[model samples]
Each structure stands twice: as C-alpha cells, then as structure tokens.
Target: MTPIGNLKPTIKIYDTTLRDGTQGEGVSLSADDKVKIALRLDKMGFHYIEGGWPGSNPKDMEFFDRIKKHQLKNAVITAFGSTCRPGVEPGQDANLKCLLDSGVKLATIFGKSWDFHVTKALNTTLEENLRMVEESVAFLKGNGLRVFFDAEHFFDGFKANEEYALAVLRAAVLGGAEAVILCDTNGGSMPFEIQQAVEQVAAELPGVELGIHAHNDSEMAVANSIMAVQAGVTQVQGTVNGLGERCGNANLCSIVPNLALKLGYTTIPRDNLSFLTELSRFVYEITNLNPVANQPFVGESAFAHKGGIHVSALMKEPGTYEHMDPASVGNVRRVLMSELSGLSNLLYKYKGLNLDKTSPEGRKVLEQLKKMEHKGYQFEAAEGSLELMLRKAMNGYREPFQLQSMRLILEVREQQPIHSEAVIKMRVGEEIVHTAAEGNGPVNALDNALRKALETIYPEVAALRLLDYKVRVLEEKAGTEAQVRVLIETGNGKETWGTVGVSTNIIEASWQALADSMAYGLLGEK
Candidate 1:
C-alpha cells in the first residue's frame, strides 16, 4: 500500500480539532459534535483526522464509535492516545488496548521525550520511557494499525538533552513507527530552533516520515511548524482556528494555505482549497464561539479594504494590495465605506450595487455617506444598512416598509416575569400591522415586536435571528447623555449581515439598527 503523503514532497494535513480544539476555553463538544467535525474535516480532504483519545473519556470513545457512519471519502480517521504506562506490557495496558479496540486503522500515541518529564512527570527512569515508546509502537503495529509517535516536548527536550531526544526517535524508528512527530508542547520555540532541530533529524533519518506538532504560547506555532516543514517534515498537525489549551495550537487555517498555495506543496486537494473559509466558520458555529474577525486566512476582515488608497489601488489591481485572489479560498474582496473612503471607493460601491457611478445621484449618495460617517455611522461594518441607503437613493428606489410608531416600556419591578416590552406599528404597502411583545431587554423586546408585526407580511423575516449587538458612546464628553451608536448583526442560519444606527437614546439606537436589519433583508430580496 502507498504510504500517506508518500508522493514526492507531499505534505499531509492532520487535523486534531476534535481533540485539542475542545480544550479551548468555552469550547465543549459532545460525541455527536466530535463526529460532525470529523466528517467535515474528511470533506475538507485532510490526510488524517485525529478524532480523540478513546481512553481519555467516554465522548472520545463515542466519537470513534459514531464516526463510522460517515464512511469517509478522503481522510484516515485516527484514534489518539498515550503509550502504555511504565512497567505495564502493551497488551495489558487498558489505554493501549482501548485504542486498538476503537477499530481505527491509524493511531497516534504521544510519548514523553523530555528527560525532565520522564523523571519527574511520569516518575519513571529514562530507559523505562524508551521501552514504553518502542513497545507501544510495536504492539499497535502488531495489531495491524499504522502508528505515529508524537515526541511530546521534543523541542525543549532536544535543547536540554539532544542525545536522549535522538535516542527517543531512534526507539520509535526501531519499533515500526510509521512517523515520528516533533512537538513543541511548550510552544515557546523559535523558527530558527525548529529549523536546526528538524535539519539534524532529517539528516539522521533520511527515509523516515517526519511530522511537527506545535503549540502557540509564544505565538510562533504556525511559524515553527512552517519552518519544520521547510526543513524536512511531511506531516503538519493543528486545530482549526488555532483552538486548544491556553494560547492554542498552530493555526491550520494559516499553515495549510501557506504550504499548499504559497510553498507549492500538496496538502488537501486543489479543489478543496476554496472551502477553507466556510470550514473555519463551520467549526466556529459548532463550538458557539465568535470567529476572530482579523484571523489571517478565513477571517471576516482578512480581505476587507478600509483605506482610501487601498480601495483605489485594489479597484484597479487587487493584487497590488491583496496577496492572492480572495475567491480562490472562498473569500471575497470587501470594499468598505469609511471616513477614509475616496471617490474610487464610492465608485466601487456604485459598481457593486449596479448604480450609475457618474450620475448626480451617486455623488449625492457618496456625500451623504461621508457626512453620516462623520456623525458616527460606520458603514464599513454595516454594509447591509449602507446598501439599503444606496438603493433608497436611486431613481427607482422603493421603500420596503413604513414605520408608524413604537412605544418601549422598561419596568424595574421585583418578581416580574419580564423587564421590557414593546408595541410596534408598521405599514407594509397599504396594510398596517400592530404587535406587542415582552423581552429580556428593551432592544430584544423591540426586535421581537418588530418581527412579530413583519413576519406575517414577509414570512422570510421568520428565519432571521439577532446574532449580536454592540453599542458605543459617540460623544464621550456627554457621558451618559452621549449619543450612542448601535451595530446589530443578524443571520438566517445561512448568511449574516450587519446594520448600524446612532441616537442619543440607547434604546432608540438599538431600534433603528434592528429595523434597518429587517428592512434591508426584506428589501434586498425584492
């Protein structure tokens, strides 16, 4: 059988999000969640998906058991665990035995490579640790499973005692380990250190398969992993969005694109490359975490252009500002509206919305946008509202709905079921709708009341949900009486859009944003 990543200089991607990503703060996945992620990773064409260590907990074991439903197309489902304990025979160790029992064809077992961990952490002699490594690899191989050995804390180990670390790798090599992974468990190693360590290992074992596992404590995990691959490693291990314990692990979202696109190494299929952004969002959705907007590859702001010069240059030649075409990775170039926006930026927006850029209307809209921005409206982050504004300024513009009035009541009373309620009056064409709803907050009550009034006329509004709300005081000198700007993010479980509003009252600001959010979605489809 051909070895995984056996093609000339092929770089195999090993995703450990199911295991390590769950360690991220506020991240918790059930057995079903783990299987769901493994299936998605398989769809992304990862070479290996390290599901989890079956022996660690019941959820991991259940993941191994349930992931079989997928019948994965491209990825090898790998079960992860540690080696047999000191003084325990491989077959007798429950953890080792559990890995084999999990019925996966590939297994990864992490073994201590640091002398300090061996003598102190495990309370065992160095020889016993080596014995544990060799015997565990040999035993797993004897069970007809391909095994990868993770040299835990290998970078620090190599720095502290190079000979012992080399011996550990040699032990795994002799024990029929298919690959030996050098891990920067502490995540503090620099790129140069990784380069030198990997160079020595590559020179010593020219034919052996090498991998790199890195953490992100010093924020060099992605850098160190790349350097290790450049030196000689063929396999890269990381969690999606860099989620892991503490500072997180190497960000696979960055590493894979660097290896496959920039460096010209085969990682995932060329066709699967575009799914990175969607895949990143998938993990974020399942984990219930807000994605870091500024993340390098799959972030919301990764390709967002805010500067006037940048928008101008990008409108002429995108490559002048962007490293690559955003569409190549399922991302799109975003021309943002801001105080920094130039005429070219407005022209870009005009073209995007099919407006006549040379017309007097375009000039008027652009001037209004700039003036409004100066008054605390940030269209860059609220394109939905910006688009609606542009559309309304056009010759054939049609208002989707007319707001009659809204009465917001906030009651602070003990033993009350709700704190706030809103009564909304709106007109759709000729029909007027009235509704009242209670909510946890005045903003929520307004949202509920507005939706209740609109949903019957525009059924699509039922799918919309308020995802996030953020407010900032625009006039800081006014203190509590300052004008507030509110940004409301809304989504329909499929796509998300942002809208903004500003007012002296917080509730009024929130209501404007919410009303604009619903109106924009309703009008855009028309």
Candidate 2:
C-alpha cells in the first residue's frame, strides 16, 4: 500500500466559497449560511477558508463578528480584499485597515498583475502598482498577519509584459508574502500555458511557496490547478462545486480526489476520503443547488454503466469499463437497467437484489423488468422502487401493505362565498380511509389528502416530502389526451429516493409514482 503521506506534506486547501462563490449570478448567501458552511469546511479539514471581504459588505462584516465566537479546530479563516488604492498609504486605506481589525490570522490581498488593469483601471503607472503591492503586503505582515498576495490576471500580464509580471511577484516577495498565488482572473488560459507560467515563477522564486487560483471559463480550472501542482505549486485555491463568478473557480470537490487518488499527492487523510461524495452532496443541498450528474468522480453517473455491452463486461470484470473502483471516492459502481440492458446486466441486477440469478422466478423478474422498461420505466433513478418491484416479482417476497383503490374528488367553487375542497378515499391493506385537504394546486391537494389517509397506520410515512417533481409529455400527437410521465423525488429525514410513473392522465401518473415511493420505503419492514 502507498504510504498515506510523507510526514504529512502540507498541501493547503484554501476555500474561497464565501468570497468568490457568492459572486456567481443568482447566488447570495446570508451571514448565517456562510458561518454554517464555514464550520462544515473547517470540520472537513480545509486549511484555510476565505470568509469574505469584511469591509465590502455589511453581511460579511457581520459574518466575521459572529464567526469569531466559534472554535475552528483545523482551519484558519482568511479575510480577502484588494491592495491599497493607487496613491493612498497602506495604513490609511479602509480596505487594508479592515483586514487588520477582522481578527483573522491570515489575509489575502489581490494586486494588479496586468498592466492594462493597472494603468487603465487604477489610473496608475506600472511602477506605482508594484509599489502598492509591496507596501500593502508589508503593512499587513507588519501587523502580525500571514499574508498571501494574489497576482490577479497573472497569465495575461505575463504574456503581455513578462518583465512586469515577474516584477509584481518580486515586489510581494520583498514585502514578506508567505505565498505568491497566480490568478487566472479571466480564466481563459490553457493548461499548457498555465504549466509554463507556473514553472517559470517557481524557478524564479525558489524559496517562496507557490499557489494557483483559477476560474473555469474554459471548463479547465480543475485541469489547470492540477497542472500547476504538477509544475511544483504547493497550494490550491477553489470553491466547492465550482461556485464562483461566471463559469466559476476550480472545484475543490474534484481537485481533492484527483490529487489524493490519482496523482498520489497527500492532503486529506485516507479514511476521510469516503466522505468526499457525501460532503459534495451536503454542500449542494446547503447551497440549494442541483448537483451535476456528470461531474467527474463524485457525480451520480460518474460510475454508472448503462449500455448492454458495457454492463456485460462490467459484470465479469469492472476494470473492463471502469477506470478505478468508484468506492475509492465514496461512490459505488452501478448497472443501470434500461432498454440497452442485456442478460448479463439483468443477472447482475438480480444478484444485487439478493435473488438467485439462475432461478425460474428470477428469470421471470428480469423479463418483467425489461418489459416495464420498454414502457418508460427507469430503474436507475428509482433504485428503491426497483428493488421493491423485484421483490414482489420473486417467489417468497412479502409486501408490507397493498393498495386496493384510490379516488380523488376536486370541487372548484366560482362564488365568492364558497371555498374549494379536495377529498380522497384510499384503501390501504384492508383499512379504508377518507380524508379532505385544501392546497394551492391540485397536485398539492392530492398529495396532502393521500398522506392524511395513510398517516394513521404508517406514521413513519409522514416524514417524507416531495423534493422535486417533473413532468414530460410522451406523445404530442395525442394532444390533451397524451400520456404523461411523472418523476417524483421523495426524501425522508435520512435519505432521498426517486420514482417514475407513466399514464394517460397526469393525476394518475403522479399517483402511481407517489404510491411507488411509499411502497419502496415500506419494503422489508415488518
């Protein structure tokens, strides 16, 4: 086995979620949310987390005030801001002073690396810009703070004026910066360019620690960060799920696993690796953002095999189709049963269900699965429901409860004095129950009524709620009479599961999926 770490080489993970991630369009996290996320990041072992620009926003300032009370074991919170203004002294600049008073042990300051930004944006000469970088860093360091100088637009600046770019880094070094971070502000540099530039800087500043800060405009932030590491950079800056301005920054979610598992770089403890996928999902949930299905390594589809040939090969040897065991990254290899499934795929899925694959009943169950999949049933997203259905098809599988019939009545009143109402009658097992509810919409009313009727016998079912519901029209030619497919995601306190239903009526489709979701949860329960 490869040694976990060589004396724990300090590969720092600098998270900028609160600072840069909030810059993404449609993302604005409150101070309370930022503090909660910061606590989680600290627990996950991020060495440094950039909380926010303290003086930039009232909310950020409040975050700093509130976060000071909590004790973070493994992380140091860093305050972020731009260097002092063109002509102002470092001690007099409000932004510089904000960093000093923020009570943070570390501070990161961004200075102009591109000559155009310096002369045009700041309206200052290149030499003055270098002076600002040097003086601001020295002032922060003099205040007993560990300073990191972010060379914004470094790659573009280097290509424009190599001498000036090197000079900016030299100024920070002379000013006592602990690390010189190269920023691809525009996020347009390719991996080759990033590698070359980083290598040159590392050579020039042999004693200084090098860091990489990249954005994903080219969908290459993760690639560029890895390239920088390969080029001898010691630190990586990123946000979880790549949440940041524009296309976003490099995703630490991807970078951590890539470095630890693939490149053999040491950072997080090996046992903690299993938490990678869980943490990725947790961040997405807290952010109220949908996790990308195809995101490398941790995504739901990252290790899922669908095609018949691929599934057949995977059954014999997973290495035939998979790069590595997905469990290494806290994900499991999945055989998705679909129209593309073959006998081997069916056998593997059957084995997963703990049924004898060679039995006659198992063969019948496999045939039924293929037949249902032909009718638009998808097992990949509704694994729980699929497992329940498989058990029902087996010889000795017993169901917890049976649905006899259900009827829904909706009454809409046009008169101002009258109120609309929805009533449901459901026969669960042998008990018949009736309930009435009012909701903003027909689906909500139906869902409420159904739950009310089932709540008596199965109080545990009340904990489930619909997280997402999607509808698709299967046949436009049928117009208003067309078949509809309903996909419903139901989550209890512990876990979430998805189920799908297809029928001519939209209400019926929803009801079918809702019933499947409930049945899946009740499966194997005594």
Candidate 3:
C-alpha cells in the first residue's frame, strides 16, 4: 500500500473541458469561448488548461491561434494530440508537428497503452507502439515543450497485460516525459482497480510525476480520481462538469472540493475554490447545457431545503441537512417556501420580512403562503410576490399603488400581426393616475401601462425592469382552458427577484405577477 501521506500535497488540476470535454453529447465550444474559459480557469488558479487538439479542426486551430492574445495569469495552456502513428517519424508526423506549432509551452500527448489497441486498432506490433510513445515524447521534449504523456487505456491495458502497460510508462519516462498519466479511457474500471493500477505504476515509474484521468461510465470518476491520489498520484485531469466522451471525465468541480475539504489534499488554492460554482455554471451556460441543480458543491440545489422536516431541522442545526456550508463553495442555501415548507421554512425564507414565526400574523402569512401554493402559486420560485404580500400584511406597510381598473384592447386582421394595447388606472396616495401604452403582447402592454402609471407617482419604478417571464400550465390536460402560472423575474438595478401569479386566464395570471413584480420593486411606498 502507498503511504497515503501528503508528500506532494498540492495536487495539480488539469482541465480538459476544452478538449476531452467537447466530445460529450450535446456540448460545443467555439474558439473565442475556449479562450474565455481558459482565462477564467487561469484566474481561479488552475494549473493546466488543455486548450484542444490543434490538429483536429479549424475551430480548435483557431482557439490555439487566438489564446496567445491574452496573458493567462496562472494556467499553463496545453496543446493536446496523440502520438505519431505507426511507421510515422515523430518529426514528420502532421499531428506531432501541430503540437509543436501550437505555440504553447506545454503539450499533452496520448499514446496507446493497450496491446489490444496495438494489434486491433493500430494493427501494429507491440514494439512499434513502444517506439511511437518513446519517439513522440522525446520529440516534443526536444522541442522545448514539457510533455505530459497520457497512456490511453492504461488501466484496461494494465488489467489485460500488466507487463506491457508498465512498459508504456517506462518508455515515456525513458523519453524524458515530465509527467505520466494513466487514463481509464473507457471509464469502466472500478475504484479499487484504479488504486491498484496507480500503485503498480508508481512502483515502476518511481520518482516520476504521476497523474490519473478517469471517465464516469461507472459513476466513479471522481471517486477513482481521489482514490488515485490516496494511492499517491500527484496530479488529476478532469473537466468542469465532467464533460467528455461516453459518461464524461471526472468532474473537477467535485474532485477539487473533495480533495481540499474532505481528504486534506490541496488543489486550486483553498481560497479560489469558492469560485467553483461560478466556474461550473459558466461552463454550463457557455455550453448551452442545463445545469444539474443537484450536482454536488456548486449546484443550485446542493444546499436547498424543501421538506418541512428538513427545513425545521436545519433551522435548529444546518448540519442536519447540509454536508458543508454552501457559502464555502460560493453556493447559497435556498429555503423554498412551498406547500412542503414548514414554519421553519417560512421563517427562514421570510426572515427579511421581519415577522415572528409564532405570531398570529406570521401564522397568517404561512397560511396565506400555503393557500397560494395550493392555488398553484409557487412561492418557491416566486419569493418576490410572497414577500410583497407578506410585508403588506404587516403593520406600517403602505400600498405602493392600488389598481382601480384596467382595460386591454386586442386587434387582429387578415395578413396583419395582432396588436395589443393597455390602459391602467391606479390610485397612488391622494391622486388617481391613468396611463396607456402598446406592447408586443398582452403582458408587455400591461407592464408598460402599469409602469407608465406608476413611474410618474414613484420615479423609483423606473429603476425596475422585467428580466424574464415564464408561464406554465397548471394542468396540461386542461389544454388551452387550463389554469396557468406566470413567474416573472424583475430586477431593481441592484438585484433581481421573482414574482408569481395564477389564473385560468393567461393574461390575468401575467397581470397579477406583473403587479406584484412592480410592488416588490417599489419596496416601501408609492
């Protein structure tokens, strides 16, 4: 067994989100996006940014050409490519030449480690594959570039022919490779086997910097990665959301935090680990992937509490529901006030409203919230509406504006677009204001007319703007006549909040949400 000591405690993080990551299903990144992500990783103190294989395509080539424009602060930009093909000279290989021409100080090259691949995939002799690994490493190292030799399929190869797998690492080390990385290419190996493989590789390649690259087919990529570290591998390679081929690579977001907080290993400077949520979401957004809210550490739901039991317990002690403080990784705990919410959930959620949880008024707000939720008004996603109403129920709360009446006009003609206009009348203090406006839709028109009516009374209404609006059918089987829920997101220059409304008529639902959104924005008064 390895000593499991923190001899070289600072584990190097190599992000392949730009390369191996893009191979995952439904993921794509442009040249400019790659540079942007690299810069973010650099600022967050990642050690390696594997840009992409310059030899792969024009987009990747463009990424390499463009990344040079920015001076990355911490990350070493790495060009990725495979070793020279069988019977191809390293200096003459097109892929190898591209790695040298990528203009990066670091290059990671993967070579076949499985003899099965040597015979079946490459149709080359095992000895020739050895030459490919050796010559490619020596050629890149000779070109004044630090080489990280990735032994692709090393674990599968090691399990198949331990002697041949060990030979691959030996050949790369002999060729002056700076790092030897064992890859579980198919992502099929179990964690114990991974630890065993790392241990054997460590024994053979003594004193050499070792790395582990595992995929998540068996859902053990992060587990195997940390296990590899426990077995004394000094470096780990992964992607932000575990983006890669098949199941995906080890998730650096989970791996880094696990290493830093749980295992006592070092990665990404403990201070910068707080940026994990931002980094994870940035990647998800850039890739146009829906973020996994339940993803560990950085996910939105990572620290969210929903159950009354859980929230009540968390009110007394957070550790009951949360493994770690959400803020430690830049994630905020969300206590959603829904039908599932308890007194503790309501109290925690509306603590900003300053109401006593056990007070009659407080119980009224809780009952009100439960009633609204029963009516399909989801406060969990619309705390803005919940807060405005709860505050209005309390003493000293003044109405921002009271709607007296509203009128909407819709027009349709053959070969012409539908037109919508709204006129709103509201009582603001001692004055009654009336305004009219036109919009692209009923909701927009109503929003415009209401804002026009209030902006004159409360110029602060100008500070609020509609950010997003989403409408969901309460009962899809009710079809067009189904009751709808409108969740409107509004911003007051400083922050954003969500408001909710429910009604059988979509326009009415939108109107209620719009009114609450404006009320939330105005805060105290007209």
Candidate 4:
C-alpha cells in the first residue's frame, strides 16, 4: 500500500480474464477473442484489462499488436509478468523486455513476498529478491510505464514472517510503483487474516494505494475481496465467472454487485451494472464453457422462484424474496411452474391474460398442470407448451392444425444402412394433407413429414429451427419400461421457446414435444 491517506469512493476494477482466466483448465482463447473481450470490458467501464503475459506465448503478443489498432475508452490495456530474474538487470531480463514491448502504458508484475519462496523457490537470498522487486519496478517506471506491483503470497508470507512481507512491498514503493496489490497466491488465507494484514499495510504505508487479488480455493475469494475493500483496499482484481487456475480468482460478477449495491461503493459506472449478466454469459460463451445456472446475480436460477409460497409473496412484492431487482443485473425474475407451484405462480405467469385463480377455468388449468407434472411434464423448461395449455383451457383456443394419423417404416438393409421414413396425415383448415419423408432417425423423419404437410399452409413453419432436444428418464429403475420426457427448443430467427411431452414410448414423447414446438412457433406466442 502506497501511503494514500484516504480510500476513494470509486474502486478500480482490474480484470485479468485474458491472463489468469485462460490459465484455468479447458479455457483457451484466440487473439481475436481477447480483443473482443477487452473491447467489451472497456465499454462496460472496467478500469483495467490485463491483456496477457506477452512473454509467455505468441497469441498474447498477437493480442497486444492487434489491440493497438483500436482505441479503448475506459480500460487501460495492462501487460502482466514477473519481476526481473535473480541477479539479472531489469533492462536485460526477457520478462521485463516483453512487458516493454507489449506497448501498454501500465504493467503489473509479481515478485515473491514470502521469504520461503525467495529461499526455496527462487533459490536466491531474501535481500537479492527485494532488490529484484525494486529494480524491476524502477526499470519499467523509467521506461515511461505505470507499474502496479503484485506481492505474491503476501498473506501467508505475512503470517509466516510479517517483517519481510512488508519489506517486499516497501521495495516496490521505493521503485515508484503506483499501486501494491496483495496476492493470496495459495488461495488458502482466512478473511480475518486478510483484513488484519491489509489494515496493517494501510496503517504502515499511509499514503499508498492498495489492491487485493484473491483466489477461490476455499470458496471464500468473493468474501475475502469484500472484506479487503472494507478493510481499506481501493482496488479489486478478479476474473469474470471466477475463471482462474484452480478453484478460480474472485468472481467480479459477485464482487462488483456486492460492493456497488450493498456497500454503496462506486464501480464501473453504476448504471452499466445492468450489463453484468450479459458480460458473465459472454465470457463463458467465448471460452466455450457452459454458464453456471446458479451463479450469484447473473445466473439463470439466481432470481428464479418455484415454491408456491415464495411465488405468492414475490407476486405481491419482489423484495419479499429477492435481495435486489433482477433487472439491475441484466437478469429476469422467473416464476417457474412445477408441482410445487401455487396459484400465485400461475397468476404471475398469466399476468397479462384474462385469468384469475378464483375462476373455474383457472382451477382446471392448475389441476391439469399438476397432473402433467406428476406424469413427468416439466412446464418450467417448456413454458411455451404450458402457455398453450392455459390458452386452450382458459381462452377456448383451438389448435392451428390437428394430427389425423401417422405411420413409420424402417428398412434394415444388408450392409448399407438402416433407413427410416414417416407418413403423416394432418388436418390444416378444411383440407387434409398427407405427406411422406425419410430421415436418418425416426424422430427426424416424423419432423420432416410434419413440416412437409404443414409448410404449404403456413410458410413460417419452414423457417422454424429445432435448436435443441433433450430426453430425461422419469424412473431409472424401470429402465426399458420407464416413462420418459422429451424437451424441444425451437427458434424462429428472432426468439426461442421450449416445449415438452411425456410417454413410455420414446418416439411418441419426441413427436409430442416436436409438434408442440411447431405449434408454439407458428402461433408466435411469447
């Protein structure tokens, strides 16, 4: 901590997704991905975007070169590396040279703060390590670059030998580093340890700027970060979706909101907070990883309500169940329909419709919903299908097309292939259209036949795309004789919707979901 007298209201966000995040297993990014993420983070008002360690790989060096062609508005592209090697001049160290060549004005470099690391890992004297830290910062500063020093393993090192860790930071300050960030390199420090250590640093280095770079090995990274902020650090270093080497770094998704909404700290332009959910999902998408559904603030299930009592309270006032408005974080509140759902969930889902819980029709729909749920139909994942059921029961809605009859044939040839075909009859308006189609599978053949029969009557049916299909076994013990539920997702180039069906027969379940998907898409009901 440089002796900065008072902590500022605004906490700088130092994002290291392109660097630390990519270190996580199964996480990799192209140079183009880095640029896209950097630009988005800048637009969202992050204070710093760590491009990557240019000394480590070609893709990172390529990122530095490519990002220079475009100007960023808010975020400063910072390059990351370690302090000069033991006994080497900072000017000649390849690591330091890469930082200079990265063409970024700001650089963050780490050095061993724990004496054990200096003695055991670096195999160098503690005094030489301090000199390395100081000279590395001085060399980068002399080259006209702002430097932030990461005192690696500061927490554990401080606990082990308090005097030496503080000495490490003092060396960085003497070398003209702008900020000193305490790193929980091993990700095993307790929050109390972090607070006590950070407070000690703030008091000792009164005018210094301090930051915390926490890891989530103990599932306390987010908690430790907030505690550090409260303990007087003015900057938070984290990765989106908590992506990092092992357990992960602190999740900026959770940290930003906890600081801004709860602690009243300013971060990333308060209004831009609504983009938090989108930003979290975007990073997961770019990394080709599935989004965590129950992740805090930005997850799909974060604000979702399912229990009847919870939904009842939430319907009257969202604050009863939600800590904060979902829209504030670019997430929406979901009133899920399940066996546990009450009339309140139904009423909330049917808010715009002319339906009331007291009505006989409404009671019928609720009973029907419960019965379906008991039989393995999950309306929560197939709200489109649920909506259709409610419309038919409560609003006397008629189907766009009725299934008359269907037949299928499978030909098992000698050595070529097993071919499947479907013949279907559908009543569209006053005419009955019969069609036949072949497909690689029975379900696909049924889909093709259904489309061929209805496309002429409703051209939009041809544009409907089956985005995803999933099947779940209701009872594993029943195995071959078990009832199954099929869920289908359909898109119309604009939006997507889900439909579900259940049956003992896989083909029948698939057809039911497929037909419902088509009907839901054709009706264009939200």
Please give the RMSD to the true structure for each candidate, in Å.
4.1, 3.3, 2.6, 3.0
lDDT of 4 by residue, 59-131 (tens): 9999999999998999999999999999899988999999999999999999999999999999999999999
Q: What TM-score does candidate 1 get on C-alpha atoms?
A: 0.87
Q: How far is candidate 1 from the true structure (C-alpha RMSD, Å)?
A: 4.1
Q: What's the CA error at residue 50 for candidate 2, in Å?
A: 0.8
Q: Count the backbone clashes (under 3 Å) in each candidate.
A: 0, 0, 0, 8
Over 4 Å off, model 1? 1-8, 352-364, 391-470, 473-479, 489-496, 518-526
User: What would the TM-scores of all predictions be?
Assistant: 0.87, 0.88, 0.95, 0.96
lDDT of 2 by residue, 377-416 (tens): 6777876666666677766776545555555555556764
Residues 370-473, model 1: lDDT tens digits: 89988888887798888788777776767767889989888878886658999988897578998899988888888888888887778899988888999999
Model 1 score (lDDT): 0.89
Model 2 score (lDDT): 0.84
The candidate scoring highest on TM-score is 4
Candidate 4 worst ten-residue window by lDDT: 1-10
Worst 10 residues of 2 by lDDT: 412-421
Q: How does residue 495 of candidate 4 score in lDDT?
A: 89
Q: By TM-score, rank the candidates, best first.
A: 4, 3, 2, 1
Looking at model 2, residue 460 earns an lDDT score of 79
Candidate lDDT (C-alpha), each? 0.89, 0.84, 0.89, 0.93
* Candidate achieving higher TM-score, 2 or 4: 4
Q: Which scores better on TM-score, 2 or 3?
A: 3
